[model samples]
Target chain A: MSSFDRNDRPLVDVRHLKQYFNITVGPLRTKALKAVDDVSFSIRSGETLGLVGESGCGKTTVGRSILHLYQPTGGEVEFEGRLIKTKSDINELRKKATMVFQDPYSSLNPRMTVSDIIGEPLDIHKMYANKAERMERILELMDRVGLNSEHASRYAHEFSGGQRQRIGIARALALRPEFIVCDEPVSALDVSIQAQVINMFVELQEQMGLTYLFIAHDILVVRHISDRIAVMYLGKMVELADASVIYDQPLHPYTRSLMSAVPQPDPKVARANKRIVLSGDIPSPLNAPSGCPFRTRCPHAAPCCAEAMPEFKEVESGHFVACHRVNEL
Target chain B: MNKRFTMHIDVDAFLPATDEEKAYMVQMRPSSTFFRDGVKRLLKNKVATVSLIIILIITLSSLIIPAFWPYSYESMLGVRPGKSVDASFNNLSPFEYGETEQARIAAGETVFPHIFGTDSSGRDYFIRVIYGTRISLAVGFFASLIVLIIGMTIGSIAGYCGGKVDLIIMRFVDMIYSLPDMLMVILLATVLKQTLAPVLEGTSLARIGVNIISLFVVFGVLYWVSMSRLIRGQILSLREQEYVLAAKAAGAKGGWIIRKHLLPNCISVVVISTALQIPSAIFTESFLSFVGLGVNAPMPSLGSLASDALNGLSSYPYRMVIPAVVISLIVLSLNLFGDGLRDAFDPKLRT
Candidate 1:
């Protein structure tokens, strides 16, 4: 984990962010699916904030809301100490930030050549002055992502998944973006390719001094790249800390169960690590438990746990947990 | 830890690959695009190839034969401005000469033989049929193109701007769907033909006549609903593609995304649907002409020609048969070609 100075101002600050999607339960009856509920976090400059959670845990929502791909239902998103309120501000934020999507097969325009795909951002932002400049920028970007100039004329379907992902990454770097929201960018790739992509991401970060809001369900990948990690349950952030601290000492019950569930690579350690298999299925977000989203599955759940949500407070320097039973457990 | 074996390579064996060897190792493929790939697949399909050839032959003859063929579509050979009627020219059988021409042949004067002979009006039947083929093909192609442009534009706009825009456009399409197709086309044709006649009186548009113009209007108004609905469905599914999202995230505008991302992805569906639309347009024009709502008097259309042939049914069945065969050939070949196109271009059906 790379350490950041305590006084370094956060590059992107999200204040009590919330994203709610209203769905009709029946004819004329609507209810809110709180996809991300009042979750707040910040990524310091050049930091990798790996967001790890279960499938429907609003991790991707958190990433998208920061970039305003999905407008937050409530809250403020401040980037580089400026509040993103007006249209021009959002446009500015877009220029400095971009996204790397999951599903490389569907993330690329099949009809366009690889050069056009990588040059799309430059075209959109009007960053280049002339055709030559644009072509130069596109070629430089393609080279940076390890693509041959000869391959630029081919379409997305002609390439393999890892190569297609490289195209996506090259596109993300098109605008010389300072931050990228990589939403499960490598989860759809083969196991061998994942390492190559993750290492490339680390290399890109170091070279370009770029920041990433890395969202994934795969813990090992997150642990490999993340400077700090945030864990979510249902729609709320359960724990946040340095990557090493969260792995060694996961205080929240949900976090503890999540850590215990990761299979150890060594046989002896795997046998020694006890799995805390929680009882019951994951409750639908629409009908989530009233207080403490994890209370329904928490082993130490008291009647008081169902009354109100616990506060996410700092229990130690740079370690935050949202559990009432943090002291005893 | 002690190594049991020392791993080493000879300095002499570490030579870099030669340029030719490197080139062989890379093994690059020649660049190709989706359109080129589709065409390659199309050429490989036997039935499609034959259908395309038939269409080419028919369409070319229709376009070319009218240039040099003797006799006009409207000229009655038996009735001259200042001469007595030559009744033998009327209703002559195929390759048969008129009476005057027969007399000339008896005097050792060569007389041209009538290829398909004359109709009841003593006009050249072969030239009329050729002109009718040209008109029918024109109406079919132009009408289908009109439908395609209007349908594709509205459909993409509605599909890309979902929620209220989609709801309103879809409901309008449903309303159009509910209207009886035949009744609407007939009513529109009648009304438009009457109105366009006067408007076309002093203009260059009068050459094609009011009926054909109204037929195009009818097709534009009525036939595009189905095409639009098809395009809308295609774009609805395609707009959700992640490429569109990536474009949006990069701050590309809606129009840009639609042009660069959405439309190109669904191009195969657009092409196949447009090809299928042509046959129906041709059929609609024929049916309209059959109902006497097609080309005006003296402007031959296949349907009107067939209707005229109905009077001499027993005597000149070949008249009706010729246009009918031509229409059938065009529609069938076009449909087969469309199927071949679907098989060739559709990524889902690539195997």
Candidate 2:
């Protein structure tokens, strides 16, 4: 365990992380699915870093890999200056970094009461001395997640989708974690309740001084909540930058196209903005594009874009982009 | 993120409720028919309910009634053989003393007492058959309980901890299952009786204890193979549930995980298996006894009584009919009861 300086140290620091799954597709044959390949990012203490990409783009894989939920095939993950290398290290890492799942209804056990679910981490980590303190902590978590204290005695299936997600949140918060992985946390929620849950997340972040890697496909949600944003294609990250710069002054052609697609609230502006529609389905990660993954669909693609993989570099302060034709664009 | 967006989201609200309460309310919700209708279908099964009641009553009677009746079939009534006796004295004896009374009467004719008739030894077949119910039911029940324990423990372990252990255990179960049921039960019971008979010969209680222990050993070992197979299939599937993964992530050990999650989830199937096993065990024990491989003479079991009736089938067919009917009824009731319980406990059927 490393000392908590609280001022300079980032809550989580990941470097060149790679996680590949060996899938057996035939007799005595195996193939690697590059689920999370050469990914690098960091979440500062008390800041939210949103990860945005389409389905199957390995956004969720990155979050899971960082948490050591799936063992990384390569690279290093350092939490508060301490490197995670073994099972015990990962177990200890879980105390500071926990995850909330995508499907709220399925994430929680149907058999467990709300209190037990919330107190599970506490029990595992031995966070409380007695039953009374455990009960008190459970009630406090329920209240923090906007659940009434009386609801602790009931099972998860009895609640609505939103309530179940709240219980999931309470569970993630049980260990008093410094960082959390919100894996499409509101994707299974109602559109109306999504705002409430999102607001609650922001409030918790402020109150607890927590850091987060909020993963989702919704650009508007990501832009609103994240201090910085990272975009991915296939299994590789293509862009990383401040949320406003990535949204407003996006340099990567993929980022530009994504931003153009989101409908602005002002109808006049929305009507005026050109929709840059990209063609063709995403290439499978098993046989990804040779160079820039977006080149095949890039409107401004050039011959050099197909020769070699582009290096991810910062063209402006705090704004990173990977493209062979960035100079031309 | 969009604080001003007010899209009317029809939320599916979950209130924390007990399982029973959740089930009832879910039934009342009426959006889906499967959950509520499944429960209704199970409740409508009449034969299953009746069989359950019959079994409960029979079990209670077998346990309770034996304490009050201390009269063994071998006990003599102290009346002179071929001598005319009072009707009351004839009533007290288990067998017919009527031959002497009739002879005296034809010397001056009179009726005598002979309820359910008699064997050549003047032992009461009626009282003996009644007493035999306890032995038959006991063999069925305790043997079935042993089978259930062995089956569930072996099955859950094999299924949950699949690999070399599962392969070895399942092969052993298969080896036992490959033998013919009747032949194997007879062989095992014969071996047990041979070993225990000398030590158990002196007292009635010892004789009864030997019979029970032999029945339990033979049937318990034989029947567990099928039950173990059933529970193994159930646990193999149940261990994959997300709740199991959740428990593991929560740091629960393998034993606690199996005890709290795996066993409770597989209970309905195990229960049905046990119920069905009871009747089959009784039938096997009865068949062994009928073939002269079960408990020996002076201790009447249903099979032994039926065997007696078989020799005098032409003159007194009632002897065979009575015991056979009881055996059939018990097996039928057990099947009905098991089927009913399976339907009721099935989660898919709950409407």
Candidate 3:
């Protein structure tokens, strides 16, 4: 991994990362729920990799695993030429890598003033020489995030959703991290506010030269900022490619169906767009299919689909798809 | 390719002209902390404000009134060595004068009037009541402090650690809960009074009396269970909040997370619970004293004063009435103040 070219190497290199939770099903019985199973992706320096899936498709889990938020059951994440396996490695990675959580309301501590919330990372890492320097840094962060200096001493509950999200972003940016996993950072806000927050995120990324793994269920929002996009089904990554290629010519059956479900805005285009309605409900992760996790509801499922999970393979420049009938489709 | 939705605009047109406008543009208010905001809300509540005033007045009177008053709570005004019990000084009603005081007034000598008159022992009843208020308030505050310290520590540890530690502590809490509180307190106080009497002989606590020590011991043993359970419930919910997770993500250690995030969020509950606990503790101390298991004689706990008054109830009903009224006033004001604190501080109750 260290042999990779400095300029070309990804800021975050995640390989086969898995996160499983053991939940008790009965009085004495426990089962492993594979929240994130053998998921692999990477984000280059100063690039945004968008991860899109339905609510329970493990998109957030993928983001969290890369940051070592939940200790991975298997596989490894290499951040900036460092294998994040040991506690010290993870702690070091945290200084350079941070997360902007999904819910603004829950992410910022209500009892904490905005200054303390944003200054927490600095305090943890001792980034300042004195109180004055710390306050200056916090004020700088607030300014970058478009928050007023006066907001520095106000509580989280006093802000609206968009402002609270900005505060969360300021805290995430406090350590001057290079990579940030933005886990649905704007999903909890109103649609009008969502666009503003997303624009702010993009602007911040450009100004700071930051890398992002933007996770969301909304493909349109993901496409707006993502340089490349990965589509996940259940706990598996089904497709990955350039953002335009993934939206324009998605290859996997699950990807095709997912693309078709997105509502077209133009009336004429909407009439022509045939929505691929998936027939069955998403199978419980507790009782996932024997082979492909998406086989139960795939429109093009076959006997071979149940025999084994299809390998994710790149069939064209920068376009990867995981499906048995990828060539035929 | 999707066409970019770009519009030519002058960005500076949106910029604020004045510094104040820039500050106000981001929906920012004058900076204040959670405690300050809570206090602001609390001061705005009329009932709570009045209750707080009443509590301050009573507390001030208790502390200061004893210093300048002409009479001592324990001093027998008319009794002297080898003198017969001063019949004229016994059981005078409020503002009434005994024979000596009446004669002094007629002779143009200045005599400090016994405002609440004298008790059967010829001691000034008003001073004793003042002293009793002081003792009760101190006991209530100290007892609640003990409960708060023990409860906060155990509850946060249990709530944060969960699993085995939680189970063990919660079971212990349950065991304490199942015990009959009053009966246990009485039994423990009686037994402890006997055992602690010798141990406390030379210490400064000896002045506090054996029954008072036993009462504190009973409080330490029994009263903390409710506080711990309340705090545990609060911490259990707060520990799972995403802010705690965010704190963890920021590389905050467990203790720091608990101190900076979890505890502050749970402070309103802590404040309200501790406030409510004081009146109950005072009530419990008075009850123990009433049953002869509280502060020893001559200290004049409100309950002891009332109990002594019972023997003279037929002759002077006001004897028992005075202490009873004082006890009710103190308890009522504290309870109302607690309710006010809850209404003011609790975010969940905010409109």
Query: In terms of lDDT, which candidate is strongest?
Result: 1
Model 3 per-residue lDDT tens digits across residues A1-329? 11122355777788888899899999989999998888777778888889999889899888888888789999889898778988898888888888999999998887778899999999988999999999999999999998878767778888999999999999999999998899999899999999999988888877778888999989899999998999998899999999989998999888888899888889899899898888888888887898888888988898999999899888898788889889887
List runs of model 3 lying over 4 Å from the truth: A1-6, A190-192, A263-274, B1-50, B79-88, B96-103, B198-201, B349-351
Per-prediction fnat values? 0.81, 0.19, 0.71
The list of candidate 2 runs beyond 4 A from truth reads A1-8, A123-130, A291-296, A300-308, A314-317, B1-44, B70-132, B157-229, B292-301
Q: Which structure among the candidates has the greatest DockQ?
A: 1
Backbone steric clashes in candidate 2, count: 15
**Residue pairs that clash (backbone atoms under 3 angstroms), model 1:** none
For lDDT, candidate 2 versus 3, the one ahead is: 3
Better of 1 and 3 by DockQ: 1
Over the full model, what C-alpha lDDT does candidate 2 score relative to the true structure? 0.79
What is the lDDT, from 0 to 100, of the residue B100 in candidate 3? 75
Where is the poorest 10-residue window by lDDT in model 3 chain B? B22-31
Q: Alpha-carbon error at A65 in model 3, in Å?
A: 2.6
Residue by residue across A89-179, what tens digits does model 2's lDDT show? 8788878788888888767765567898888778777999999999999999999998978778877777789988999899889888888
Model 1 alpha-carbon drift over 4 Å, by segment? A1-7, A266-272, B1-33, B78-85, B99-112, B349-351
**Pairwise TM-score winner, candidates 2 and 3:** 3
